[model samples]
Target chain A: MRRWLARVGALTAAAVLIAATAPIIMADDLTVTRGAGDGGVAREREIRDIKSEIHRLEQRVDQLENENGQLKKSNAELKQNADKLQTSTTQQLSEIQSRASAPPSPADFMDAMNRFLGRYRFTLVGGAAGSYIYDRKSNTNTFALDLEPIILWQLSDKLLFEGTIEANLPAGSSADYQLPVADFQYFLNDYAELVMGIFDQPFGDWYEDQSPFWVNRFITAPLPYNVGSLIPPTEVGLQLRGGFQWGEMGQVADYTIWSGNGPGYTNATCGSNTPPSPLPDCSTTTALVGDTLVSDNNIRLNTHSPGFGGRFRVYPLPADSNFGRLELGASTFDGKWLDGFWLTSWGVDFNYFRDNLQARGEWIQTYRQMPQGLGADNRQGWYVQAGYFLTGLQVPLLPSELDQYIDRLEPLIRYSGINQRATVLGNVITTPGIGFTGSPALYAPHAREVAVGLDYWFAPSIVWQNELDLELPRAGGFYSDTGQAVGAYPNDRAFVSQFAVGF
Target chain B: MSRLIKFGMMAALAAIALVPLAPRHARAAEMTPAQQKRQMFRRGAQLWPIYCNTCHNARPGGEFSPTEWNMIIMHMRTQANLPPQDANAILEYLKASR
Candidate 1:
């Protein structure tokens, strides 16, 4: 019985201990299982989070790569642009240098000038002459130099102003200056023009066309158009002039009409003191030759009346005809002289040029009504001139060097005459280029002259001219009451040599 | 009649006669540039001697440049009473020849 009790108590104690230990073990096991489950869930959540993060990081890296590619493309475009700009700048610099180095062409220079000033030009045209004269009757020799300057100004397309200044210098004499022409012209159309101020009178062709030192064939003018002739060489006037094609055959016609101060008259009477019984009323007679003395006004010297004149010219042949030009002209001038006396003049002229030959002629007639019933003083004058250039002659046998010189030679001839009808006051005239000395052939009522000339042309408008003139008096002799022989003047001869240039 | 009145009448008659001979602007405008230039040159050659020879010898065309010819023609137009058409044609010829 005692052994069984001991064994049982031991067994109980052991069982109690076992039970406590078992409970502790069971609790520890449950805690371990729960911890294991929780740990597995936490690990799964972390793995999912990590996978999402990796996806986001990959997207960010792709974005960085795209940005890098864009940067590279922009940089390439910038470089191309810079290269183009540099090339363009270099080309421009070279062009500028070349332009700066080259000289401007004529057209370019003209363009530059045109920009500075409107179309304008300045030029000088003139003639110069040196002459030596030998007079037979007076046994005198004279040397003279003349200069003429012609200026033309074009104000516009239709307006023009022209002037001529003539300067004459004779050896041992004071210089004389004359304004031959100064005029303003306005074109009415292609065919008509109006001229104002002093101009060459449109009378015969001599004064208006052929009086220039370089143009005239001889040093001296013809007898009819000399300084003491019936009409003045120039006049202050208003003129209407023009030319036009007349027909389909190419004929041309020109006309000129002018109004100016008329001629004057002078009469000589015993001046305050009467001469001795044999002086024949008056010692000298006064005559009115030309009315150019009073250029400023028409009232001086009884030249109040206005003169009317006109000229008409016609060219029958075609302008391009091989025969050259043939021109025929008619002119007339009529005016009132001093004391209401009539002074009328008419002229006809012809010019023909063919090859190297030129021929021209003029006839002029004037009638001056005298005061005190002295009757009309009728005057007639005529001149014919011809010139032939040696170039027209074909001389094959001449040496080549001599041909050039021979071609420059021209021979000219002119015959001029003047007839003055008797005046009741004893017809007496004062000659030009000579003092009031009594010269028979020059001062005679009727006179004739023959002039021959030889010209050597250095250029188109420069020439050396040699001329000889013969002056012959016509009609019967006349003697003043003082027994001075006026018409008994013997024939006279003159020689003149001139060097002229027109530039 | 008074002398002035007579002269005026004469001038009037002359102007009347010249009206029909005026240049035809319409005809000139209708031509081509080349044709107009050629015609002008021809007309200038034809009229050169007729006008220039009346006073002095005709100068050579090569003596002046185009600009110089223009000035010379303007001067001669007034001095010689040349019609505008003739003057212009002469200028063209001178320039062309040079």
Candidate 2:
């Protein structure tokens, strides 16, 4: 039994060993078979397929490694580029900050000022004159100096301010100062302007256009434009004036309408006592027409109503025609001088310019209704003037210096007259006190004058003028302040020389 | 008479106020800048003597600087009651001559 058991154990062990070795033997046998037949070929084909896949996988792994290396290199390059960009940006920023803070130079300031002043302007312009006068009737020789300064301020395209001051100084007399013009003008449109303030009344062309010393060809004004004339020299109020093209033929028309303080009358009653030497006697009542620069109608007669007037002028011919410019104008001013009395004045004027010749004329009529059935006071004045420049004359025979002066010469002639029908106080007129030699002639009932003048222009605005006048008065006489009747009015001859400069 | 005068003044003022509202003539065709400048110069040349000679002799353009001419023209504009177009034309003529 022991032997059998031992043999069984051995067999068992052998069996176990065989059992383990049998699969190896069979795998060896199977490999041998696969290598030798169709199944072996199929097994070899499968191995080949697996090996090809392994080769492909190896190639993919190599490709992935190369791509990863390239990506790392690109990342490094991008970091370098970013660092360079940041450095450049920092340098540029520093340079820009360095130039921002600095002071402007003078040239820069001037440029700025020029830019600012291009639209607004302020200027000063004026006229100055000196004159020598010899009056035959007064038997007096006098010297006078006059200065007129005009200030202009252009605030904007449509707004402007203009002011003029007239200063006159005469030998042996106090200096006279007057504000002739001070006004603000606003342009409403191309054809209209609204003016406010004290301005030369648009009664006639002479006062508004040619009254300045440098502008007037003669030294003395026309008869109608003298002090206390039919028309007021200036008015304080509002005016609308402008010019417009009238027709396609180049004709033009201008108009001015105004409302302001007109004229007033002062009724001075002689005192009960025999008046002072210069004062008129109590028997005759003197009425003074108060139309001076400082007299306002409201203040003089307590009349609250304002004066209404207008002037309309038309140029019938083409303004640019070789025939020259001809203007016809009509003006009317009507207002109440007293509670129930009215002072009405109207004027017609004409101006003609051709080549070197200028001709102008004015006719004015004034009617003042008297109170207490005193009837009406009528005054009429007219003046016609002409000036011709000697530019067309060729004086080759004269010396060069004289010829030049002659070429600059202008000959002027004027015929002026005034007719006062009746005195304010019936047929008897009281003459004002004799403050100067020619005071009586100023109140003449009928006066006529013929003036001849010659003007030498040093420049367009500078001239030396000389004028001679022959005055003739009507037969009527006036009562002096002493209540004495003075005989026929005196005829006088006067001469005036003036040097004027306008700028 | 006073009432008549007041009424006339009111009518005149009303007329003046209504002038801008009145229908204006149709403008010509659009002008080139050069053409417009030429037209302005021509008009100014025509008006220079007509307006300036009315008061005094026409001053030489060289008598004043361009800026000075501006102020002077502004003064004369109001003094002479020249329309804006006419004044501008005169100014342009003066500046160009200068």
Candidate 3:
């Protein structure tokens, strides 16, 4: 084993020495070998070629080692970059999971709620009205009841849409439903609005404002504002109206300008003692034309030109002034009446509101040129009303709990009158014992009404209204018995009790 | 009618946008509490001619106290299905005004 190790060691040393001598031997013999004789040159050339080949191999090995070192460094760097990327991705995923598990904030819940409720809003107003009447002339008693349903939708902060449906249900008039108003309003700002659809006339408080049956002291409307009366209480129209503050007391000025389908045609027998007649032979009643009017009373010249009017109201007193709030207003309209007679109407109104006291009044006049050769005549009406709340009296009998149910006990008084005169275009009076028998003549009557009533308010929107009304007429005039016409009468009286509720 | 309506709406918006730039009274923030309340009441009163009064006259707000108004407003809110925000605004106005 020792001899073999020595021999292997000696051989390794000899090979190393030979390898070291090859490069020097190639350098020293290469020049001489090229010039030597054929046999000597062949030997030298062979040795030189071997040394050259060894030198080239050694250089190739050095190049491979450098390449190998670069490859290892590059591998290390790539692994480090891969590890960094993994760590970063893991941390990001952990952060996302942590955030997902956290509880929501109050703002998140509020935001969700806002998004849920952002679309639309709805409102409904409903109630019942009950009435009992006693007529002196007829000596009869009657009772009636009705339901009033009003619905509204607020599409947004700038838009409002509302509707109403009223029916005299208990009187067997449930099927006869009336939609008084279906309106849409767009607010332009604090001072202006655009309103359209079928709505109450913007004339006076009597028609423009919501006069709930539960609020008024009387069961019936005033003489001038009665059904089939002189004024257009409601109409389908578009209105541009608004209120503004002016003067020292923050006095407000409210105005409305509108156009709509004018009132329907009226026949000469409107206020006459003549009873109703069948169509064809009958000139339909021209007074207070509703949505459906007979051909005889459809005298509108054009769709948009049928009617146009405006009203303006101003508060003359400061808001906190000693006199409280006082308002004065005026309204006017011009339109074509039945038989194509040009008609114009004008009115003035006022209202005073103070603590426990309210007073209001209105005066209206209408003029129309008679068709054919008949001259124009003027018809006029007026009413004044006042109410005083007795809650201030603090009656000892009133209970504390009752106070919640009964806000006020008010005594009210009102006087209203109507003077109607229309010239007959032709002698077409068909009813017996009515009108000028032979010829067209002036037919005018003066009707006056005085009512004294009491209002008991169980809640703000619920009340019982009791009233005694006196009807005075001079010349020819029609009267009502328990809300039914009893023909022309000199003097008539009635007692009415009404119970109303508004939800 | 549609064209007229569109024109009217544009004009109205233009007028409104320009109106605030016009000279007016003192700012609401600068006014006293009573004055502020009065202004709000007057502004709120405009809602009456718009919302109510389709058939009859609107009863005066002064007829009831603030507490009474609260009760009435609550009933009306349910009856009329008034939006919460609008109901709140109207109640606040009535309370301050009365």
List fnat, each candidate: 0.42, 0.57, 0.03
How would you encode candidate 1's per-residue C-alpha lDDT over A1-503 as one tens digit per residue? 46545655664575565556655655655565677876656655655565565565556556555666787899999999999999999999999999999999766776687678776655567789887777776665777788889887777777878888888775556887778788888887777778898888788787677888888877777767653466656777798888766664447677888887776543433322223222234334444222111222232344657887988888888876777888898888888776577788889999999878889999999887765344567788888999989995668887777888889999999988776643222334332232111122443446687889999999888999998877765632223233333444467777888899988
DockQ of each: 0.36, 0.42, 0.07
Every candidate's CA RMSD = 17.4, 14.8, 14.6
Better of 1 and 2 by TM-score: 1
Candidate 1's TM-score reads: 0.75
User: In model 3, which runs have C-alpha deviations exceeding 4 angstroms?
Assistant: A1-118, A170-174, A266-304, A338-340, A394-407, A422-444, A473-488, B1-98
lDDT of 3 by residue, A366-461 (tens): 776654343555678788988877764654876777664344688999988767542232221221110001000112235677888888776567
Candidate 1 residues lying further than 4 Å off, grouped into runs, are: A1-122, A265-302, A422-443, A473-483, A487-489, B1-9, B17-26, B62-71
Ranking by lDDT: 2, 1, 3
Per-residue error (Å), model 2, residue A418:
0.9
* Candidates by TM-score, descending order: 1, 2, 3
Clash count (model 2, backbone only): 1
Residue A90 in model 3: lDDT:
100
Residue range A200-241, candidate 2, lDDT tens digits: 887788777878888888887776765346776777788888
TM-score of chain B of each: 0.77, 0.80, 0.49
How accurately is candidate 3 docked according to DockQ?
0.07
Q: Which structure among the candidates has the greatest TM-score?
A: 1
Per-residue lDDT, model 1, residue A148, is 87
